[model samples]
Target chain A: MSDNAAPIQLFAKKARVYPKRVWGTFRKLKWASMVVLLGIYYLAPFLRWDRGPHAPDQAILIDMPARRAYFFFIEIWPQEVYYLTGILILAAVALFFVTSLFGRVWCGYACPQTVWTDLFVWVERIVQGDRVKRMRLAEARWGFEKIWKMALTHSLWLVIGLLTGGAWVFYFNDAPTLLEQIIHFDVPWGVMSWVLALTFSTYLMAGFAREQVCMYMCPYSRFQSAMFDKDTLIIGYDEKRGEPRGKYKKGDSWDDRGHCIDCTACVQVCPTGIDIREGLQMECIACGLCVDACDGIMDKLGLPRGLIRYDTTHNQEAREAGLKERSHLMRPRTVYYTAIITLVGAVMLFGLMNRAPVELHVLYDRNPLFVKLSDGRIRNGYDVKILNKAHEDKVYSLSVKGLENVEIRVQGAGEIKADQLHVYADSVGHFRVFVVADKPADARENVDFRLEEVGGANAADYDGVFMSGKP
Target chain B: MSKNNEIDKVSGVETTGHTWDGIKELNNPAPRWWLIVFYITVIWSIGYWVVYPAWPTLSGDGERGGTQGTMGWTQYDQLKEQQAEIRARKSAYLERFENASFAEIRSDEELYAFAVAGGAAAFKDNCATCHGTGGAGSAGYPNLNDDDWLWGGDVESIHETIRVGIRSPHEETRLSEMPPFGDMLSGEEIADVADHVLALSGRAEDSEAGAQVFADNCASCHGDNGLGDSALGAPNLADAIWFYGSEKGDIMSQVRKPKHGVMPTWEARLDANTIRQLAIYVHSLGGGEE
Candidate 1:
């Protein structure tokens, strides 16, 4: 260690960012993204899908009590949780593909944190005035105007947070019913706790945490650079043209000077408060707001636009070298990601299309595996569970194979015939089945219990073993 | 450490007393919001300690032997509350079970399902020791799943037998006994009767002498065909399901000195609804008579 080495201070006070309001193409684009994303998030639960009378009518619902997940036309059983894995994989690869091409568009436009923070900032701006006024108010002494303005801003932020948390819970329950419960203040503790937790987190994260969440808390920002290539699009400064910059007068020299007028419009409008003219840093979200701000500045100064712009490193280098820039969209990374996305999507589609309406599970009795009857026959007991996934009651005829002279008898079925088992709609029917068979040559014999839906085409088979005393 | 107290010129913030090469560490404090949240958590922890049992008492003479917070919450109390909730949920079904007869219970699908589940749980706790967990009995005990039963197999008969057990201490118990004929009948006669009993099940050759001995000694309780009557709690000798071993020696020993098995009366132990549930569960095991 160096003798003059200083002991490091681990903590640093956060520098508050007050992004000034700007009217440009990217700003409009960001507003549109926020409106559309928040609209879908807040309104998605109210969208109704008819699942007949047996299932919930919510278009997208996670019925925790029923252990079922319904997505439009598809219903997911607890046993079929692989579909969730498939959906997650698809989402991940799609994000990778988009990141490799456009660079952090998700972070800029589509992320919940960004949208909510933008909304909160918009509210703050509307209540307390824009950047300079907000800074002045923060530095000003305590007063009624400051107190009222700050209170109004926080109240609006809290209301938005409450709505956001409230909308999130509607996805897990029936929307209209839960809305009624919430109106009446009759929400269960389990649901109320989740609502409060999400409310507090949303309020804190969007209102105060803001860009600090992106800079330190978000894992995506830390690792997203791994997906970048030279051709990956990013927000950067054209240092080749912007350097040797000085303030422009009404009439300035056109020789040996850059077009940049040293106006800090880009930095003033940046949400993360990092100067884009310093070149691309990890804090840059690639939102292109800096480009919009610089373009406005260039138009005012009667100079060419794009001192800061969205460009690939390769293109920037090519432009510096006086060569034509080209884009490579078919790189191996993108190709692999696309292939995986397509394969997983196809597999999930096939599985959903061919999902069976009936499933059988058989558990052989362990204690006293085989009982000897008075007729000198051996019987094996099984607990058979039939999951009827359809919307109507179904009677399934059960039979056993791989054992000679096997007779199936169901307990508690009364006069409904020994082989016919009745299963209710969209529920599991548990039956204690006794399979009587002649003594097998081996101590344990493999048997298959075949269940065929009466008057229907669906069938399921469960493999089980029949135990007997050694002859 | 040295005390240079150098100032960083770029951001106009004071640096730490020490410097490395040309770079100095700035002494920037944490954000005010972070400090506020830290203080809030500290206050919350104090409140939590005041409301919950957070500390252990050194003295063993305390009521709880530890710090009992104002809330006075205990894991046992939580368990009891959870159990009470479950019992309240099942109270409706239990009321229906108490009011309904065996036939009515079997007819109603929900009531039948509840009975079976409750009965299976109770059976595992009480009856699974002597009878196997699945009711496949040992050599002395009878297999509940088999067609042959010493008493009766119907649900009502099973209920009555469970209430006042076979040869139990209860006054109304189903009592039957096979007398030990070792002194009355000679050794040769006992062997002959044992052979006749085995022959009734086709396990041995039928002999005239064995038939006479069986009619004289066992025919009073065991019927003429050797199919013992359920009314008398006499086991059927004609079936392959035997309470004791079916070997020639075992039959001869039983004829000489019969072993009687007693089942405890459940009326004194279980509630009426539980006894009925057990009866239904036993009857549903596949061999209950119509």
Candidate 2:
């Protein structure tokens, strides 16, 4: 719009950031979430589940060796991979639910990047002083004191990293035992290596990479626009109200300009250091620290609050035009997100309820589908697979029915004195059984294979085409 | 860190200065000690990756992925170490349980204490699923460690129950199956016979017309006394130990429907020594019928 053709665009000069601390409701929420989420991650592994004597006692463990995953009361085996799928769906929809309701709440508060960076910043404040001092220290001449500052800060960061790494491996095994093992310098190689790798990454990401992860590497940051709309409550600066901004003395009245004193305190406290007055940028985490800072400034200046606040474009425009609209939280997109979240949750619960403890699989012996004995009886062979899904073994008998006048024969199964064999718990057992179809040698396609536990008749049936030259 | 380029060192590690969000570029070198530690760990991990079963394939060519390191270290070896530790502890318990006479061990002061500690843990792991923790009885699963036993509760019988287990196909395993009364009698006739059978156990909800059918057909295994035969694995009808259930409907269902419980063969799954130990362990649980 600037009609000065001779003027070439000069890229905005970068300013070194030193965000001063600000506290308010959003900050408190962020703090509480950080504590709770981080607490669960670090402490969960130390909790114990007495799964009798046989199973590992570490609750919420991911037992890689045994291929078991335990979460409190729920134990999932590798075979129950659908549970993992359900979990992934639950995670996705749950995110949608959270996003729709609070609007970027996860990004502002619960995102690992936000939480860990908060922690690292706290540690940095404790060791090297606040943002101002840290900035000054970095800019200070290379002296022994500066060296000490860097060493102290980096050391603290690495300690947090080490703790993070240590906590991560605990999820895989008994945390207390692993900790002891690590201290003794005899942790399992796989575990130790993973801990080392995780520690290094945590240190680098939280300490050095910092906000760059969300800015450059995070996929969520790149595509969050697709999920956003004008109605969504975003960290917004009311330009109509704050524009014509100019410096105001402590109590001086200015009727010509807006309430904004242009103190730029909001900019100074912003974690991303982006001026919200420029409109919603992809970089804004919507942390509301700016809102808190601006509110503090407006209160001191005796002006109406909300220089920067959670608001919408539509609401801002309506307010300016003197016709207000009620805030809409139940938009179609939010409704869709909630419905999807509930649907996925219901499906997961249903799946958990209907899970079977015992199952069966039958493989037909295809090499010789059927054989004709000299006695003129036809025999169909089958490889019956029995799965004992229970924690205990099963003694199930192999029997046949659904075909008129058929005698069941099992090759390895001792004389028909009994029909059952012992199947191990959490394992599959295969038996080669021969069914003497009493039908003529010309019979075909009409038979059922029944596996019944002798005396204990929890029977399973498999229907196979009884072949005899296709009838 | 840039792909396919070595650091010239003259122009040091300068970051690309594009700050967005609060993330800014820092012009600094990776800590020398940090990089050294990183390299060492990476090299060590690669060495481990090259030597272990790190990858899986459907073709069963898993060995092709690893170098088969000089020490031949494997997950199996680690598992073996754990197993060895377990075995060491187990041997102590097994020696005391299997070697000591039940009465002698049961009566002794210290020996009983040790057996209780070891047996409690073992039962929790193995027997608790079916036998119930602390030998508490469920419908189908029996109450071990109780005086009530169908076969015999003597040391030998107890050992036998534990060795082969009831209704198992462990070669010398205990075995039995109730004949399908459905095949033997018409549905109506079976109900009559069921009533008669229930009557023997003082649980008659019907007439005595079908008592002859029981005396004629069922007495062979159930005994003329209706107390049941141990050799035939016939359940004692007189006692309250109903294998399926103890209710009138349950008893009638058994008479008409019949209840047959199966015990898996312990032979292939458990080692001979372990089976011996388990037998003694079950015997100590009390239902080792003499």
Candidate 3:
């Protein structure tokens, strides 16, 4: 350590970014994506599907109290949580496939953070004017116009955040009922806490954090380059054509000069405030807004478009060499990701289609595993749980096989039939069943409890063990 | 420590003035927002210490309990509050359970389910020591799940038996005593009677000499056909189930000197509602009669 050296500062203040409003093809594409994504998120909970009389009609709901997840006609029980794993795998592989072809497409278009921040910036622009006016107001004194405009912008951002948070909670409950509760200011504490938490996070992340979230916080931005190869499409600058730049008048000659005029249009319109002329960087979201800005400038100057554009490293090299440019969409990474997505999607679809309506679980008694009745028969007590997922009450006849002279007795079933057990719709029937069998040759015997729906095709079987005293 | 004050020539960045071997660290600062978050967490920890019990304290009079924070919260108090909430939820079912008769409780499905759940919990805590976890009793303790019962298997009878207990210290206990016949009968006579008792259950051939002794000694309480009377707490002899044992030696020993089992009355030990739940639970263990 040096004694007379200048003191080292450990923290650097953030440089605020003010992205000027730009209009082009990619800007219009971003707008369309934001509208569609937000529309689906806010309106899907209100959609309804008729699940007959016994089940809830909400189209997409996660009923925590009931331990059921209903997505349109498909209902998932807690035991079938592997479906969620399959969905996650499918989503991950699909993202990989898209990223291998078009770099950071998910980050630029579909990500909630980018979409909400763009919406927030638009609200700011509407209230405080565009980039120059906003910077002027920030530097100006706190006058009545500045205060009211800033307050209005923040108030609008908060309202948007509240709506976003309120929409999120609707997925876990009946939307109409929760909306009514919210209208009356009678929301439950659990739902109210979640709504408030989400509201605060959305406001902070969208209104204040902005591009810093993608730069310093998001893991996707840090690791997404791993999916990129030389063939992957990325936003870049053509340094071979745009270097040795200088300002030009209307009548300037085109000899001994590059096409770039050093206008800084790409940098001014960048959401993250990074220059594409600096070459490929991690901060670039591949949003193509720079391409739009450059194309508009080229139209004005009678020069060709794509001084800064979406291009692969290989294509750029080929163009510089005066060769043809080609896209490789069927690379090894893309093929592997596609195969995984297909395999997981197929397995999930097959499981959903073949889901059984009945499930049987048999728990053998732990203490005194077998009781010797006075009649020389060994009786084993079992707690049998029958999950009847049908919409109507079902009667199931239970029988035990692989044991000699097995007699079944169900407690509290009231003699409708010896083997018939009535289970209510969409609920578990818990029965204390005692299976009495004649003394077997061995001390223990493997048995199967077969439960078949009465006059129906649905059936379930559970493998169990019958214990007797050692011979 | 020495002042280098030199910039690295290759990267054109200043050094942090510390060198390890040939390496000099760059003078790149972290983002200000990260430092601001660290400061916020530090302040939050200070606020947490004020709001929660964090430091130990000693009183002027030498008491050593820790300082009670502004919230005045403790884990024991939280546990007590949670337990109170559970009791409040169960009071609705417990009130009905206490008032309803055994038949009324049995007929109502919801009330029966509640009673059974309560009974199962209470059984594990209080009764599992003697009667097994599944109510399969050992040599002396009666298995509540079996059809053969000494003091009736109906819900009401089970309730009464649990309340008073057999041969217990309670004044109204179901009292029964089999007089020891070691001096009254010869050893040969006791053996013959044991054979006749086993014969009744088809365990032995009909013993002509033992029949007269069993008729004179056991017929009054065990019945002539050996179907036991529930009121007298006498076990049935004709059934294959045996309290002591079914062997000839066991029967002879029992006849010579009978061993009486004592069940403690639960009325004083547990509340009335818990006793009723226990009775319902024991009766529902696959064995209660109409």
Candidate 4:
């Protein structure tokens, strides 16, 4: 501690960073990914699929009011929400598998934050000029030129944000009808409010939050190192070859000095404003932009490239120890992640293929458990619900088993097989049934009720109690 | 203040020289954009105060309580506007429901839904106290969501029941009385008759004696098979549904001195539209007979 230290102030000023543009392998990759991902996001809602006249035509739709979700050829009901959980687990494991091999690669290339931020920056460069001009304009007094440029940049950002948010709402409703309703200003207030909220958040996050989201807001950044090991590929600086870093002229002494000229070119092209020479850091997105920058400088100086490159810590250590560098991709962690991913995928596929076309729920009446009729017969009432999951109308015949001398009577449909009840496609049909039988003193507590489709697709069975003697 | 400020040794960044337990506090500022957002929200809040109902006054005298802002907005006004939006959305259905007969409303799916929703709201406010939520009735109150009906289960029968009610003071109320036999018969005879009635429901071990008594006295209103008479509003005694109770003692008490239930006349209280809605809603509760 300094003896002449001044009194502590609560806040310190922030240092703003203005990153310069550069051309490299990673930059080209990022550009290609941005175009592809944004294209898919913007165009997916317009894609159409035919499902006869009974269902909407949007290829991917979540019909919330009807409690149904349609994805291309598949339709999911509320009871099948476990499929979503399965998908989330699959995605998480895939991410872990990738992260174990290549550290922070997803964060750099495919993260929504990174993609949108890149787009925002590209727009900013087009509207406000390059890094130097932007910094000058930022430091310069607010003039009319600055105001117009800033306004134009923000307006374009808002447009992109609007498109992003608009695309999201299209998934929940019939896309064409909802689009018409939105155009006519006839949509529900909730829809308009959600669109507005999502638009503002997107604009704020992509345009302004930028690096702050990666540095502080995103939980993925905090726990990312948990998936990383010494063997994982990361953006690293060859300090032994680059440092003792200093400026060099054309004919400077090459006997003792490292190849690095201390140009700070790596820092100039960095999106997160981190110094790669400071070694591997949490801020490094592993974008490899610095590698291209340093490689360009090394070419000019006639030095071998890769002073800053994608390398594993173990490889770097081995190289320093005068051993050949190697990578281990088939590690135990990666194998385990791959195995789990494959297993989960196979199980979900099987489940979807063998999904039941019909479901039944039987609830025995509780108030008066059993009614003893004048003819010495005991009658039990049940409320049965049958879900017909097929795409057309169906007729189902109801029956009961697990009891002797039982007689079944559905309220609307009679006991005979010819008196089949018609159930609408993709809907549930409710019926009140009375199961009358002799009071067998030695009968089991529960009985099975079976509903078979009349010369149709499937069957469903439900278990109900045969309450006797009392409530 | 400048005397206590210094650059941190490790990071070479300036720190607020205040140290606690040998740990110094870095003075790094919050992001500039975050500060701008904070300022924007402050301005927005001030603007909100100007337009919305925000402040409170000592008098507490306003149209909807609290200090009225410049825009003169109230929560009640917003609620009314929201309701108007919903009404606009369902205007076609509402128009049909207003003009259609009960049969027509029942036949049309859209109109039926509109009526049922309106009836549900009305039922929650007026009928749930006695009829139970979703009309899963308690003892003595009929479970509307069942195949059993005292008078009838048709749409018109339900409409009539709601309009006049059962045992109400209204002139058109469905009226019935089971004369108390407590004073007319001996305790043994009452017990025997209750057992026979239980036998009719297949609950008793023997009903020979009570069957004789039932044939002599109860068979007039209750059919010989105890199937009940809808015209007289008598319940089917052999069905699992019981209005009063299912206990043997409950049956004996009913044979001795029956407790009659009364439902208030809705026509005297609710509007015609509401009554029709209730009738449609009750009819659609999975128990309506064709």
Candidate 5:
């Protein structure tokens, strides 16, 4: 012990925050982003795209049982999962690009936590009243007025949470059909459980957790400084001009005094309730409502606006040093991130454009590698599987090469009428093909088989081995 | 130990009677809810020990090994219950398959689906040994999922073949024999006929010379284009599917000393309903004909 200190306190009770509502440029931007993002989330599942009678028609769907993912006109089979990885990489690099230029702008404006919490707070304000009234009501004794307002506010929040959860399940199933099934209580128990879980989490996150999710739960907020640079824009106070804060008088001399009036308007309007004059803090969401509050007071006082503003640290330092503003946006980090994002996007687009419409897989019989007929001919059996990715049935003609005098026999696929094989649309056709060669050179030889569409340009080939070894 | 009971400077909490390098630990109590969760887990573990098979017995008897819980829960018992539930669920399909006629079953899509599912299970359990897992038959056995059946390829014929078996000891087995041709024809004659059969499938270089030999020695059972008669259980030598093999040496050996394979009568081993299921399953393997 130092012998001059008091006993330690391990815990401190949380001070309830009642941020006074304010409007500005950032507030309008945030409101616009929330509307656009939430609108897309709730309505995208209902958007329909006409896939033929054999496939789902949803514009964006994850058809689990069919093992297919449909995005508008593009259908992705199970084998095409790498496209999702490409998308994730693109999104991550794009986020890095945006963050390097704008700092925690995404966290303040478009994060789901911020948007849902804003909606919940707005609902609470409508049911109750403004900040002072809400604070008073919280401290007041239980009454019918308080009880009704609290109940109404919570019920509205729950309704929003329910809709949020309900919209999520529609992406996995046909939206209109699932809605009908859900209303009639015919939905599966597993689907119902997912809906309930999502509903509870949304309600808990938006209603009561509020800013705690951004501060304590979200990992992005913890590592946000890594993306920030001296030139990156952030919400900051002009300490050089506004410091030595004090209340102003009408006949003040304007000598040996800073411009700040110390009205605490900026602190009062802060969503995370941190004093901006204390420099930047991790809890500050940089939403810029404080800037609007300060600007309003400055206008009233006949002073220049922007006592709090969105500005870069380097620009602020240069201005204080009486130098012209200069920005360095073409940094090495941003250039590399941009290049990687472009490369990934281009590669994925190229892959999607070049994907073949037909695929061939050959499974040579493992047991009895080859059979010998009385005619001195060696035979090998193969399960030739042809996947027709087209939307309509296709007739494919089969041919074998790389071995002379090879006879192809497909069981039940009678006579090689031009060596044709019929495969249904969007399905795999399996044929037991027996390749016979009279007096095969050596015990085994590499052979190539091709399945060419009877009248179309699409074709696929597989290299297989013709075994003439003992059975 | 000298500064163990002293208070920490900054936190304003009492020391925890411990110190490490002049940094005193705080005597802070855990959150009440956290302690409640801890107590709950302690109680849950005791309850679990009482309800489930937990401890070994002192007796060390090999049979009555462990202490049985009050609930009498065992992993084997759980498995049996799960299996029983699955069987109960499938009983509806079984009842329909048992009562419906083969024609009736085939006409109803739902009944056919049930039969196919039940038949697939039976096929894997009983028929997968001889017939490859997918009915892609081995060298000696005929591939059931092909159109190259010796007797016939129709569903009815398949049912009869499965019930009576081929060359089985059963009284009504489908019996046939191609008397070893080596006794009558020379080895060179057999080789020539083999080439003629290969030429029918377009595998041989020439069939002009062997065509005369084939007609003279093999036309009675093997029809005119080397397409054998299915009515008498003779395979179509014109096709590429060779039961024994397709090699020249294999054919010469078979002509010299024909080794006929026998299939046991399934009716004697399996129930009639199961045999019916096997027939439907075999018929559904894609190569079954009308």
Candidate 6:
């Protein structure tokens, strides 16, 4: 907006932000969120489960070998993949719901990118002696001191990245057992490769990429406009108090001037480095670091805080008119989002509760639909798939009925148990079963292949179709 | 600790000049590194945008979108290579086994191991649901891995089980059936002999009265010693193996209520060598009779 027939500089020299640190309610909330969220991310993988001798004991695991996922007391088999669909739906709805209540809180504190980058920036400040030393060091040529600082900082970032990647594989197996394998250099090459890839990606994204992830690469940022409304509580600057921002001369007093001293501390503390006072922006993570910085400034200036704070637009405008007041947020958008969240969560939980532990699939062989025996009887072949989803081995007995002249011949069934077959826990076992009809069955006839559990724990029945020829 | 400094800080910056817990803040400039970082990050980001598929490409040629990137790398390519490697290994083993007889393959250590691995996977894919892991053979499904053979345990017989299957329609398919003993004998008599049959397997029970019952009815199919006849498809009663079950109660129940297992022939679905490998695995199951 700068003008007067002169080309504006694409870049401008600006004052550096020296946030005189302060404390208040919003700052405390941000500190709490940082602690809780980071704590969960770095620690959740270590939780344990006790799934007996045969199963992996990680409390939350995605056991690709067993083809079952475990979470505390619940285990999901491959057949129950719909639960994953339900989870994804629920997550989307929950994101919408939260955004409706407090816009971009996830961006502000909970997002993995935000959380890690915040940590990384904190580490940078600690190691390089804050903003000044880091800038001077970058501008200066490489030296022993500069090199050591860079090396130390990068090594710390790599360690955090490694930890992040290391925790991921622990979700797929027994964490302790896998850790031992990793330590002993005996892990599968795929696991090691995945670890390396994840570590590298995490380090690059959180350490170097930082806010750019949200600004450019994230699809959520582009699509999220649909979820936001005027009632959403977003980090907004009050132009009524802060603008016509100007610096007071030596003898000026508060009565004759506007509240803002134009210090730019809010701009400096921002991880995304966008000015809140300029207005709302897509780049702002809404982290409230600005609010902390500005509130500290205001306490010193003998003026009210919240020059930059979470407020709705209507309230921001009202306050600009020197009429500050609270606004209601439980409007239509919030109600709709909350309803969807509740609905999705309920459906997901219900599906998890009713999920079955066994599945049976049958494919009737078609090549030679039926063969006529010397006895003048006909036979039909069928391939049966029996999946055992229980946590222990189970033996199932299969039977066929409805056809009067039908007799079943499983290769070893007569010598074994006539109807019973056994399978290991959390596995699918296939078998070939021939249904020989003493008389011909109708073409494209379907018969029920019923499997009844005869032994072990968690006995259950599963059914599939037996295919045959024309009557 | 320094009231004069605290008062000066509050006087200009809008502070109360009143110190809280004696920690007064200085109005010093934020570190210069932070400012430099902000600009550097913006510049570096633009550079990255040019290299990776970070932005939507101007040309809709989906190479960086739906199609492969400039690197031409793809998950499909990786998967295809892995599959090709597996196929190479399998075809070599298959080539070796193709020339060998079923028995020869069974005895060959390396060949047998390869067969077992392939056969077990095939079983899991095609047979394990009914035949327990290790081919322990579930009830109503004969344990091909066991020594007790209703038809036989020879490579040809086992192959026939995997090929034409039991009671199957192949011209030379093995087929045997015993009329329900209940039809031939009274329910009471069937129960008595079922107990005696359980006793024959060295199981403990009241066999004193069951002997007469077995001599009259079961001898016809099971034969005199209850050794059974493969020709008749009756199972042997003396060797500690049971088709329906070895338990007295299970045997009695089967006698009271007859049951049968059904298996479809695999020859029509799979190739010849896979059947050979399956037979080899089953025959090598420690219980295969000569």
lDDT of 5 by residue, A1-471 (tens): 376766565765666677777777777887888899899999999998998887878999998888889888678888889898998999878878888888777878878888898888888888888788889988988999989988899899989988898899999999999999989989888788888888888899998888888778888788878888888888889998887778899888657777789988898877777898888778878788888889988888888998899888998999899999888899987899889998999998898888779999888886556655544566677888898888899999888887768788765322334267888889888776777777567677888888899889999999888887752
TM-score result, candidate 2: 0.58
Encode model 1's per-residue lDDT on A190-237: one tens digit a residue.
Answer: 988888889899999999999999999999999999999998989978
lDDT tens readout by residue for model 6, B178-271: 5566666776776777778867766658565678877776788788888888766777887756677667678777776567665777888889
Worst 10 residues of 6 chain A by lDDT: A13-22
TM-scores, chain A, per candidate: 0.96, 0.86, 0.95, 0.92, 0.89, 0.89
The CAPRI quality class of candidate 1 comes to acceptable
Residue B211 accuracy (lDDT) in model 6:
83
Q: Where does the lowest 10-residue lDDT sum fall in candidate 2 chain B?
A: B4-13
Candidate 1 yields a Cα-based lDDT of 0.88
Ranking by lDDT: 1, 3, 4, 5, 6, 2
What C-alpha lDDT does candidate 5 achieve relative to the native structure?
0.82
Q: Tell me the deviation in Å of residue B228 in model 2.
A: 47
Q: Give residue B81's error in model 2 in angstroms.
A: 20
Winning candidate number (TM-score): 1
| Residue lDDT tens for model 4, A20-86 | 7878788899899899998887777778998876677888888899999888887889999999998
Q: Per-candidate DockQ versus the true complex? A: 0.32, 0.01, 0.24, 0.12, 0.18, 0.02
The TM-score of candidate 1 is 0.88
Q: Model 3, stretches more than 4 Å misplaced?
A: A1-13, A141-145, A413-418, B1-101, B188-213, B224-227, B245-249, B268-272
Model 2 DockQ class:
incorrect
Q: For every model in order, what is the iRMS?
A: 6.3, 22.2, 6.4, 8.2, 7.3, 17.4
Question: Cα deviation of A7 in candidate 2 (Å)?
Answer: 17
Please state the error at residue B165 of candidate 5 in Å: 4.9
Q: Backbone collision count in every prediction?
A: 0, 10, 0, 11, 15, 52
